[model samples]
Target: MRENEPHRTGPVLIVIGGLPATGKSTVGRAVARRLGGSCLGIGTTRQSLYAFAEHGGDTDTLRHAVTHGLGYSVAYALVEDLLSQGQCVFAECVNSRKATRDAWAALARRTEARFHEVELLCPDPTEHDYWRTAGRALAEP
Candidate 1:
């Protein structure tokens, strides 16, 4: 949001969750772009943590924290910062556990931001399998 712009609801926290290959990133990024906000992915955060660790900058043991719940923690902090600035955020992740989803909602409440959780599911197994395969192929060098 620009300094001169006005937002009706302050900021919004959009959490997109689903199993792998459910199109969370695609949807999240598209929505973020449309909303003129930021898009964040859990895998991207984890890779960042890994890269920093590889570069020998674990000031707070971030590498070890990544193995735990640091990615979500970092995401929370990032989202909170953006919300404080009146910018919406779209966060896509495999919230495979209920605890993770709950934590995201809790963060939204703590920040007094509107929270939306969208869980994508591919009911067609064939298409889902193709997405999974394509995702793996894309990951391969």
Candidate 2:
């Protein structure tokens, strides 16, 4: 994100997405590191929402229903700001739906930043299940 680098003028948004426990976060972090940029993860954003008490409540289920939308809103705003400053960004999300994927691409188009889509897949059911269950438990308190 240095000012003197030529790539600064050409902002890029690399989106890493896939099914649960497919290594999307790992790949997104690696891609962001390689590009010398920052990473925005939806899971982390959602967790933050939970921590901040912005998630589901008895009064209204609308916020709960739009949890993903809330994450995307924050992510898109961050992307717009970062791209406007000519900086690269990496976004990590499950992105299980075509609409979600297309929305990200549209965000890139609007920001005038180069869009790179990376989808990770794990063919081995055992490994995928391990990460889906045990891996998460080990990583969390």
Candidate 3:
């Protein structure tokens, strides 16, 4: 912070979530780009975590952690730090459960950051399935 800069209240944390083929990643990245902030994606983070574990971390345990709540826990800590520095953040996740969604909201409140929730939905099953299959085609490998 500059010596003469105005005091910041809090940064913004935009939560983008939805089903598997709801375009969470696409929308999260675009919004983060447009807003000039950072994006923390669960899928991306999961891959990174698993790759990091390449040193000695067990694949099964890592997978379980990522699937359960480890990803969100890590994101929460990261967002807390970023928000403390007045950096806006965009978090994209499947967020298939109420508990996950509430955790994001709670993080915003705890950090005193503005909470913006954007839930993407593909109402058309055909389009949704197409995206899902197309996404699978572009595997992480």
Candidate 4:
């Protein structure tokens, strides 16, 4: 088996962070698949939160904060669960803030698991803008 194979033993938290349309989700999923673990996306968590809140009754700011808070909690819980099961986990999020990145590092320390931070970026501004616009258009209702 490969060095990063799930059966190799030891828990790992693979954190994938990037801007919109930077392919964090795709890379995270690919990494998780290669490692035989699971992938979690903050966007998916946010969508679930919106569904749970019935898409109403809150200001956008409040909704965003709540969703982000819950998403972080859920990510921590997932990492803990996978660690307990001797499995690896891949998490994808924007994670633009230092505090957020530190929190993942702390989680790794608390869980005594290996942590890998992968930051995806698009070097070409024009191509990045094009991809971001296309992604936004595809994601819109």
Candidate 5:
């Protein structure tokens, strides 16, 4: 039989939050890769909103609201689903506000999974601005 297979258990939930150009997605993906887990990007959720707006669903403002509202719900659902199935998940998002962070924490509580918050910071102002602008340019496609 396999070695130590019976002791394996559920996966951990890692929630990453940061500002624009803060490398939340980059580092979250790295952590998830190392841990053999999955990474979910909030931007992917927003892109779906943009697509809906492009298809004449709503205005930009409405799209933003709907994306923000639905994105968290979707993210939470992903984490819950992964946990239920004995898998781990890593979520990357700006999570600029305390309320958003708190909501994730609450989800962790309900799922009985450990939650970790990691913030990315750039010590050099110039470097931070450079990365921010460069990231924006690359994101523009």
Candidate 6:
């Protein structure tokens, strides 16, 4: 059996959150990969909203409401499905707002999963600026 499969003694959810360019995606992806699990990114889902909207989807008002709600909605569904299958999940999001973070925590509680929250920060302004400007990190620190 795989390491993750054996460790599936219980559900596990790793939630990574931070400001843009703070490497939340990188960390979440890495952790999930290391554990042979899944990485579900809110930003990816959020970006897809634009593509859907471009395809004659909805009005701006509806798009805005959907964008705000879709990430959490999809993430919660993924978490539930994966956990039910005894799979680990790492969720990456810009959970700067307390409500959003609390929602993730609540989902973990509802699923009876072990919830781990990781808030990333870049201490070096130079590095942070570089990542923000280039839209990528030079390396994971």
**Best-fitting candidate, scored by lDDT:** 1
Give per-model TM-scores.
0.84, 0.83, 0.85, 0.84, 0.84, 0.84
For model 4 the local lDDT of residue 19 reads 91
Q: Look at candidate 3 and tell me the lDDT of residue 65.
A: 82
RMSD of 6: 4.1
Using TM-score as the yardstick, the better of models 3 and 6 is 3
Expressed as tens digits, the lDDT of each residue in 60-96 for candidate 4 is 7657765658777776787778776767888899999
Q: Write the per-residue lDDT of candidate 1 for residues 1-141, one digit (tens) a residue.
A: 787554556878999989889999989998788768889999888878877878766545877789798888888888888888877889899988989989988888888889999999999999999989999999878
Per-residue CA lDDT of model 2 for 62-129, tens digit only, reads: 45744748767777888779887878888888888888889888988988999988888999999899
Q: Which regions of candidate 1 deviate over 4 angstroms?
A: 1-7, 56-64
Runs in model 5 lying further than 4 Å from the true structure: 1-8, 60-62
The TM-score leader among the candidates is 3
- How much lDDT does each candidate structure score? 0.86, 0.79, 0.83, 0.82, 0.77, 0.80
Model 4 has a clash total of 0
> Model 3: per-residue lDDT, tens digit, 1-141?
666444435699998888887888888888677666889888877777777767685878887887778878888899889988888899998877889888988988988899988889999999999989889888746
Candidate 4: regions farther than 4 A off: 1-7, 55-64
Clash list (residue pairs), candidate 6 = none
Candidates 5 and 6: which is better by TM-score?
Answer: 6
How far does residue 32 in candidate 2 sit from its true spot (Å)? 1.1
Q: Any idea how many clashes model 3 has?
A: 0
Cα TM-score of candidate 4: 0.84
